[model samples]
Target: MRKTKWFTFRNFFHRSSLTSSMKPRPVNAYSFVPFSPVAMLDPTILTIGGVVLGIAIIERILERWGVIDLVDQFSKVMRFILPVTFYGALFYFFATFMF
Candidate 1:
């Protein structure tokens, strides 16, 4: 005997019936409309922002502390830096069009 699974979903009671049962009507429609830009932000943007900031900060701090000796080694970091700037530009295009 499974007891009919309790019928536990929120919508088991119809809205009109819910109105009668509750006396005062709770809500006419859904309350909150989320703001546009924040909603527009996709996962990739957040991930890139976090990763780029973290890497740049670490690189700066390392450079400041005199840890990386060879100035030529900065060439490797510059590779990543250029593409990050390009990614920023593409993201701007996305913001302009898609969002």
Candidate 2:
């Protein structure tokens, strides 16, 4: 005797649902750490420095490639602006979150 296509499909879904329901539900994995302003200061500075360095490197690459005159000019402007922006943002985060 041949099983009908609909019967096989229905059985597949039913079996899957049964097995899924029998398995234990997953536990929540997320854990939060309490924030410490003093602990964060050094890492925050280092992160800002890293970000500035990365931007400078990318700008240098763009200048080397000579892709667009506008990008080269923008890169030059950003070299000074990016550090200031990152530093300002860091200050803002500390001010808002820590204080």
Q: Of the candidates shown, which would achieve the greatest TM-score relative to the real structure?
A: 1
TM-score, every prediction: 0.41, 0.37
RMSD to the true structure for each prediction, in A, is 14.4, 16.7
lDDT of 1: 0.64
lDDT of 2 at 36: 70
Colliding pairs, model 1? none
- List clashing residue pairs in candidate 2: none
Tens digits of per-residue lDDT for model 1, 1-99: 634435446656543342443357576775374346664466666676677677667778878888776434765876878697767857764676532
Model 1 sits at a Cα RMSD from the real structure of: 14.4
**Given candidate 2, what's the lDDT at residue 2?**
59
Candidate 2 deviant stretches above 4 angstroms = 1-41, 76-80, 86-99
Residues 20-91 of candidate 2: C-alpha lDDT, one tens digit per residue = 425588898854756775755676666877877887787778777986786778777887888788779678
